[model samples]
Target: MEMESDFYEAALFHIDRERKLYSSMPSRHYHNGYEIFYLVSGDTCYFVDDKAYQVVGGVLMIINMNEIHKLVNSSGETFERITLEFKSEFIEGIFPDNSSIDIFSSFTKGLPMIKLSGQEQGAIEKRFDTMIHEYTQQPPGYESYLKMLLFELLLFIYRKMESNPRPALNEANLVHKKIFEIVDYLNRHYDEQHTIGQISKNFYISPSYFCKTFRENTGFTFTEYLNNVRIKEARNLLTHGTDKISTIAESVGFESLTHFGRIFKEITGMSPLKYRQNYKV
Candidate 1:
């Protein structure tokens, strides 16, 4: 699907894993939006931030904006999920003064996997059904109604979490701690040059070990993750300004316009200017 650039946006989907082997790996990437992933009927290993999660059916994984994540097909079983993504702009537009409360609390460090009871699942599913119907029908005032439905869905999950909090993730292991530290470093320094060897030296690990561990845990090579971060930021600039595309590329760490244009087109399927023209508010 092409990238969505609306200030207020929502989508619903049903996926069936019939064509591919469960061992087919998923790409690691991030977006400028919150993500709610509901496993409908599936089993997969989800790698988010610095930890791996074994996700099964009837569970929801909430990911905050710009958090790197991917789903790996570990078991060859039938896998399906419904994913919803909306930008913070969407949330803020709906709840101008109350968006903070609507956010999933400490989503980055907390256990984001919410296992729903049968009744709760049915309620959430019904909300999703209504959302799909309203979105597809696009009747009068559907945008406002869509926003209301999204808020209701989020409220339901928030109440479920408050009523039954999951235990915090155990990050006592030295390796996990180090990995998180590396992730933090990257998030802070994505505009700067980063290399596997340099990062390994900073983290006091051999380059080979760092490569293996990073891929195993985050499902991304250092360079791949860095490019994704840069591209995401570039998209933000494109949407918010009329800056010269070359300047935006340089600001986001791409060294040359040629290279930046190639990567931009590769990820977004549109030239930077085209994307801006399409999405500019």
Candidate 2:
């Protein structure tokens, strides 16, 4: 079963409990809202940013806006999960005088995934169940009620994390470890020029092997991932700084303004100037 709701474009809730296998790999993607992913059953490998986490039943992944991530079946079995995504403004003034606690700090600064104890999982899953019921029923004032439920869920996780911080369950295979290191390198050095042959030589892996392994682990070809990283940073610069479009293009690793404009439009659906005009704060 699956259920989804879009609350006036401010938030979304989705629940899936099907027993199925992935016929094709899902693409790596990012978005402009925070995401909460709760694994209800089965196991999978979740790639967040550069690290691949071994996500199992009762695991929760808190992803900040614009973080690159994807999920792959690790056990070749069925899985179920619930996803909630919301913009920061959705809960901006929902809590009165709650100035000290930033409920979303964990998404931005803390661990990416948390393994909950049996009891904690039951309690958190109960909240998710209630939200599902409320959304399905849509009784009077249910929208407001759903917002309250969302707040309660976030608060529960916040408190639990404050009390018992757990480390992420990272993938341990040697190949995955090396790929993650390369991913981290790419993320940090997206502004620099790179090529598959060059990166393969630097990383001490054969070019063919590097290409195959990178796509298998990250769901993106080497060039695709590099372009994504550069474009993500370009978006940040466009939205936050008053830099010339050509300068921004060169700064984010594009050799020419024409190439940068084309790729930026391909990824973001708009030219750099238009994006900056629309999204600049």
Candidate 3:
């Protein structure tokens, strides 16, 4: 979706599983803002950047700008979630010195998902309920009240993270941790050429095992995942920058402009220039 300034400075959503039977698999997407995703009930698999995480109710998934992510139902049972999306500027505008709030430190450090206990979940949910009510009511000074509620919720989560260290946010298997390290490296170095052999050697694993583990964990082959990351970056530049198509291609690690053009069109259904023109705000 195109970024529109007036669309929503900040917003919240409550999605229930009963309403998803006809909903297609959402296209994996990223935005210019941050997202706080809380699973209210049921089970789901969340794919963030490159690793797939199995998350249960009461887990909070944090997403920063340019991180491609999506959710898929992992169980047939009912599911529900509350999502809050906001621009960094919106928060800074409210509290001039908002750097003291470190709710997103873990997210920036690559630990995006955190599991909360029953009591903690209830406390956070109550604040969200209040915000939703105020939002719907649109009472005088509702915005100020909503901001205060959000700040309190953020502080609560921050304290929880500090007090309870090493929550079981993902699988504890050694292989899972190893693969996550590689995925993290790929995300940080997507502009450089990477090969399975080279990555395996760097991680001191055999190429065969690296290939198998990466696919099993991310649901995408190494080459496919790398290309997806590169293309996502290309899309970001196309929509928000003045870079030339060739420059964007090379900067994102595509050696050939023809190959970049083909893949870009296949993934986004439009040429680079066309996409930039169509989506530029």
Model 3's TM-score against the true structure = 0.52
TM per candidate: 0.50, 0.55, 0.52
Q: Sort the predicted structures by lDDT, highest score first.
A: 2, 3, 1
Task: Compose the digit string of candidate 1's lDDT tens values, residues 1-281.
Answer: 74322232233322222323353336667766678877654346677766676554456888877777778755554555667777655545667687457455535535667766434554665577677677677899987887877777778777767776653333222234466567656655767877887888989998988776665444345675566557767876998887899999999888889999988776566788887897687
The model with the greatest TM-score is: 2
The TM-score between candidate 2 and the true structure equals: 0.55
Worst 10 residues of 2 by lDDT: 2-11
| Predicted structure with the largest lDDT when compared to the true one | 2
Winner by TM-score between candidate 3 and candidate 2: 2
Q: Is candidate 1 or candidate 3 better by TM-score?
A: 3
- Candidate 3, residue 87: CA error in Å? 0.9
What's the true lDDT of residue 197 in model 1? 79
Clashing residue pairs for model 2: none
Give the alpha carbon lDDT tens digit for every residue of 189-215 in model 3.
889998888999999999998887665
Error of 1 at 79 (Å): 1.7
Query: Which runs in model 1 stand beyond 4 Å of their true positions?
Result: 1-25, 96-106, 168-281
